[model samples]
Target: MSLVKKFATVASGTLMSRVLGFTREMLMAAALGTGPVADAFYAAFQFPNTFRRLFAEGAFNTAFVPLFAKEIEAGGIDGARRFSEEVFGVLFSVLIALTIVMELAMPLLVRTIIAPGFAGDPQKYGLTVALATIMFPYLMCMSLAAMMAGMLNSLRRYFAAAIAPVFLNVILIAVLGHAWYKGADGLSVGYAMAWGVMAAGVVQLAIVWIAARHAGISIGFKRPRLTPNVKRLLWLALPAAITGGITQINTLIGTAIASTQASAVSSLALADRVYQLPLGVVGIAVAIVLLPELSRALKAGNLVEAASLQNRSVEFTLFLTLPAAAALLAISEPIVRLLYERGEFAASGATSTVSAILAIFGLGLPAFVLIKAFTPGYFAREDTKTPMVFAAISVAVNIATALMLFPRMGAPGIAVASAIAGWVNALMLLAVLVRRGHWGHDAPLMRRIPRLVLSSALMGGALYGGAIWLAPWLASSAPVLSQATALALLCGAGALLYFVLAFATGGTDIAMIRRNIRRGQAAAASMEE
Candidate 1:
């Protein structure tokens, strides 16, 4: 499909998954509150998710997809299948070994890596270990699913892989419902949720597996071997994983520091949920499609088209991310309060604190999305190490700033540190691409970015004013309906104002968008064949 249409397709599924995830977080906030069990579970949950982000979504896909796409383009199905099977075998064995090792080292892992603070409370510490053990198996499932997703994306079949994540939220939400129905205690609920996480991974893996088969691609289990192709993949994937993994590693650092506090882990987790909506819908959709597009274009020696695709994707990234960031910066507290303040978190809630973190994330949203848009410029050309070096610098910056600020600003401090790192990472990546003569900006993109920033600023102002006007409705004792209504109106006003201002300022190019949309069918057939 056309890049825009492929983005929309992936984004639609991502939107669904993100919405479901938001619901699940709301449910979790209600069920777990800001308690010890909640803290333990979130910390433990971070373990598997960190690896999932590292191996599945981050490193593995970033490394594997471009290579896989090139193979398919150059050698066709048989060539691609042989490579995929070898990597699958190695991936499966490594994951199984990793799972077993993690299980055996559960206590030490929990004590040192996952939740050191829980060590003070035997009950909490023991439970976290148990839950992490149950969830550790999820890493194995999701890594395989991620490989399947990479294959699908390379094949231009993004819907299934994008949709697969929704089942995770669905299962977790159902588990949360069951917990409430059963009047389960905090730890009991936490345990069940952990199990639900593993179950969801299994189901996600199955769905993607079936989808891959339907797409005329299947890599069944085989005994592990170190073939030449597998060795090449490993050489590519290891560094790719590290570069892709830096963000998650930063998150791990933040969570580890947060774990030392009573309520910091839960607060950070909820804030992450709020910000991930835009990041997932906009950033991930572009990331999923951009690599293959760039890889294919560059392979055909279409340097001009490759540069254009990157520019256009970067253009869209800013277009969508600015409004999303403005809206969040404007209405974060109210949105968080409306969505999360109920059951255990009640009236006043932890919403304000989490909102602070969300706003910090807003400051960095453009940088984060731009990083995704830019990195493919490097990765598609097999230049993973440059990004990895830049990523390592970002991670060190994040860690140093996080440690310095955590003592003063708590979780919000951590968020700001990460945002700073994002800007550093993005600017450096952009500079590298420019220096290497790979990324070039067109007149339209160069002309519009400043206008986009101004439009976002205007929207932020409108949101601030609306937030003030809707103060009563957003207050603690306000009816949930009133709060929800006010938040909705506030968001609508901000979005409407952003679009009007953006267009008036010559910041947006709607005419180009329509033409791109028209080309989807032809693009789809070309990619599939």
Candidate 2:
């Protein structure tokens, strides 16, 4: 399949999941507001999710995909299957042990790492710990799911892995909706959501397992063995684990810094959810699909194809991310108010808090997407150490900046620190890639980047101006009409400006894009047949 088609499959599924996630958050905001219950739930969710990203998405997949691809290439199907089973057995045992440990230590983990929002409120502090304890086991299920996802991606079967997350959002929303309709207390709803998280992991794991089975990959728990294959997998996974830890440390720093603020840390998380929708849909979808493909290509000595795929992924990321960052910055307040300003959450402070964080995060969207796009180059070649070094530097910068800024700017300071860290990480990765000649300033990139930048600038200016024009309407008493008008005008203006500038300046190759669209449609049709 064409790169665009692959990206589209991943992107479409991700976009669906994100939209549902947004709906889920909206309901939570309306049902519980930014209160102790909301704070507890978000913190609880973050605990498992942080580790899920660190271990499963970041570490396991990074290590597993390349090695699995190598085995498939070298030893064919049988070898790949055996290697995967061995790795799975080890991974299963380790995750089970880790989950047991985390469950026991959940209180301490919540007290230290996830405690910022709950410091002043003893009840919230205690409840967050309890909720986190209940949810910590989610990491084990999702980690195993990630391993299954890796197996699927190695086989170039991206749909099930890409779509598994949708179940998570759907189940959470269902649970939250049920609680809200039943008019359950905030605490009750929060627990329901937490339990929903665990349940969703089960569903996700099942879907991926079935998909892997259909793809002719069998995964089972055999007697744990220290086989050479298992050792090799461990060797590759260690650097990935460290790299993932560095990345997670960046978030931990932000959480710690934001904790120092009062009454708004949870709101910052809400804003993050808004921005994460686009980042997750566009950035992560592309990364997941591209990484395994790049790894296989590099393993087969197809440097040119790998390079081309890398370039396209970068371009595609920029194309989607630039305007999204601008739009979020432009419409942060209205979007937050429109979606979240209801029931107990409909407070001026809540709107301001979410808006501030969204705007700050907007500054880093491009950098965040680039990090996803660029790091795969190293991982594709089984070189996690380079990215790990850069990640350590980025985390240090993040910590320093957050400490310095939080004293003055409060929660916004943490957001600024994260943005700075993102840029630092992206630049460092790019520099290393260039120095090693792993990535280069190809003609397409050189020609398109300036145009892409220009288009983004145009979109930003248009959105900013449009936002001002729509501010009176947005701030008016009629919430529905004002929000509708504000969102439509701002988005429409930004979209028009970006596409026009892109087409006018040759920022997009029309023929190439058209061919990709056609290819994606054909691929979908073939799958249906």
Candidate 3:
């Protein structure tokens, strides 16, 4: 498939998942709000999820896909199947063991990691431990799911993997809604949500398993073996795991700092959920789809194509991410109020927390996207260690900044620390890439980046002005309609301003974009034929 078509397939599925995810979060906010129950739940949720990203999605995918792709290229489909089987066996063993350990250690882990949040409140602490224990095994299920997703990605079947996340949101929404109807505490909803997470992992695994079967690359477990292929995978996975762990250390730091704050640290997590919607849809989708393709291109000595693809993906990421960052920064209060100010959640608290964190996180949105775009360069080369080193530095910076800033800035300080660390990570990656000559600014990038910056600045300015002008109306009586109208107008005006500036400053290559879209459509049609 053409790159654009491949991107579209992944992007469309991701967009769908993100939309459902938004609905899920909205329901969660209404049902749970920003209370102690929500705090405990979000904290509990982050534990399994943090590790899942580290082991399954981040490290495993990076290490597994390139090797799987290589096996296919070198020895055809059968060899790749054997390789996958061996790797799966090893991965399954490790994850199962890890999950068991985590389940057993749940209380201790929560005590150490988020002690402050739980220290003053015994009930909250107990609930967090209990929920975390139930959710800990989700790491195993999702790790298996990731293995399945890697297989599908290796076969260039992007749809199933991308769509799997939607099921997760659906299940959570259903559980939360059911719990709400029963008048269960939000903590009950949280436990339900935890089980929903495990259930979603199973469904996701099944979806990708079916896709792999359809592609004639399915495998089942056999007697465990540490074959040479398995050994090689483990070796590759070690550095990848370390790299993923380092990246997540920043998040761990942020969580730790947020825990030390007041009763609503997890509400910051709720606001983060809002910003992560766009980040996950655009940044992660591009990263997952682009990585294996880049790996294959590099392995096949197609450097030019790899470079072109990287450039295009970066352009696409910046084009979308900048506008999203602007919108979040400008309209965070209204967005938060609209989505979360009902049921048990107070409008004032939600507005304050959301506005603060949104502004802080918006500062780093482009850098986050850039990190995703640039890391593929190293992963494609199977040099995960380099990124690990930089990631460690970024983590240290993140932790220190959070420690220093949190006393002064509270929950928002943690967000700022994370964002600044992202910038640090991005800069380090870019510097190394330039030094190695793996990624240098091409004429197009050199010409377009300034324009992109200018366009984003214009959009941010317009959004700020628009938000101020509409603030009174948004804060007035008839809040729902007035707030919605204000948000829509501000977003519309900002979008128009961005487009106008982009077009005038040559930030957008309209002709190229249309040509790429047409080519993608033609490719899809030919595949159907």
Candidate 4:
């Protein structure tokens, strides 16, 4: 398969998961609103997710996939299996200990790192501790799953790992639906959501485990030991884990600061969910696929191919994210209102707040995606230390900016801080990569980026006007069908116009995309052989 095809496989799965995630969020908004339970629950939920990203998605995958791919290249599937089992044994043991420790220390963690602002409120603090403890074990399941996912991705089996997240949303949505049907209170819904998260983790892990088994790797238990490969992985993983932790620290800081304000935590989360759709679909797809591909190229001493891969990945990222950012900025208010301004989420206040945050996040969308494209340039070459330094700097900037703005601008201020930090990290990564002569924009990327920007700008203007024209139908008092239709039309028209403009302005060429696809497929075929 070509790069585009691989991207599609991952993106399609991500798109489904994101859409279901939106549905789950919508139900949460209806059932819990931006109330205390919602705040408590979101804060609690973020605890395990923070660790999952830090350990599994960020640290583990970054270090594991490249090494796993090398193992396959050098010693074949049997070699890879031995390496995986070794890592898994150690990983499993570590996770079990971590979970036990976290469960016991839940209250202290809630009051300190998780959501210090909740400390004053006895009910919120207690509830956050309880919920976090229930969900913390999810970290173990997802961590093991990440190990399996690394195996799958190295084998060019992207769909199972990419699609696994949908179960989380699916399970949560069902929980919310059941609770809503029973007219459960916000507290009841929150508890149900926590349990649902735990169950989803198990389900997701099972899915990937089965997929890996089918792929000819059935990881089994072994006593933990630091084999040479396991030790090397741990060595590489330490800096990567720190880098990932720094990124999450930015989020933790935002949450802690936002927790001081009423409804700010939930509002920021809702806004995050909106922007995450594009980020997950485009950025994550690029990150997951690019790392292994680049590693293979570099490992084979194919410098030119590695450079092309990075440039095209960056191009592909901008091509998709630019228009997404445009749409988010264009219709943020209407989008938020249509999606969440029902039940506990009031149009009068929460919608505007969330919309503003969403728009701010949009401004940073491309930068966020670019980070995904750029990091593989470093990680593929086994240079985790550089990115870790950059991540620390970015976190510092985020902390300083968020602290400076939160007192004045509140939740949106945190979003602004995040966007600024994203740009800082992305620019630093790109600068260093260019300086090291590790990546550069080729002719197509150079020529097409300007056109993509122009196309997105034009689309943004059209979307803005369309949103205004459809205001009546998009209003809070409008029929749900009318609102849905209006939103869909605006999105459809914006997308159509963007593509048309992209083609007309020579921003994106049909012929070039086809060539890249062919090149990607040819590359994949050669790797397989």
- Which one is best on TM-score? 4
The C-alpha local distance difference test score for the whole of candidate 1 amounts to 0.87
- Least lDDT summed over 10 consecutive residues: which range in candidate 4? 241-250
lDDT of 2 by residue, 279-339 (tens): 8888888878888878866876778878877888898999888888877776788888887
What is the alpha-carbon lDDT of model 4 when measured against the actual structure? 0.90
Q: What number of backbone clashes does candidate 3 have, counting pairs of residues 3 or more apart or in separate chains?
A: 0
Question: TM-score of predicted model 3?
Answer: 0.94
**Separate clash counts for every candidate:** 2, 0, 0, 0
lDDT of 3 by residue, 126-193 (tens): 98898888778778888888888888888888898888888988888888778878988766788888
How would you encode candidate 1's per-residue C-alpha lDDT over 1-529 as one tens digit per residue? 5788889999999999999999999998888887788888888899999889877887666888988887897789778887888889999989989999999999998888887877888988898899998999999999999999999988888999999999999999999998889999877899899999999999999999999999888776778999887887787776788777776888888888888887898898888888889988999999889998888889889888788788889989999999888888888889888889998877326777888998998888888888888888888998888998998999999999999999999999999999999999999999989888897758888999999999999999889998999899988789999998888888888888999998999998678787666655565587568
Task: Report the candidate with higher lDDT, 1 versus 4.
Answer: 4
Candidate 4 regions exceeding 4 Å error are 244-247
**What are the lDDT figures for the candidates, one per model?**
0.87, 0.81, 0.79, 0.90
The superposed Cα distance between candidate 3 and the true structure at residue 376, in angstroms, equals: 1.0
Write down the worst ten-residue block by lDDT for model 2.
Answer: 519-528
Q: What residue runs in model 3 are displaced by over 4 Å at the alpha carbon?
A: 114-116, 242-247, 515-529
lDDT of candidate model 3 versus the reference: 0.79
Local lDDT at 361 for model 3: 87
Tell me which of candidates 1 and 2 scores higher on TM-score.
1
Q: Report clash pairs, candidate 1.
A: 1-524, 59-241
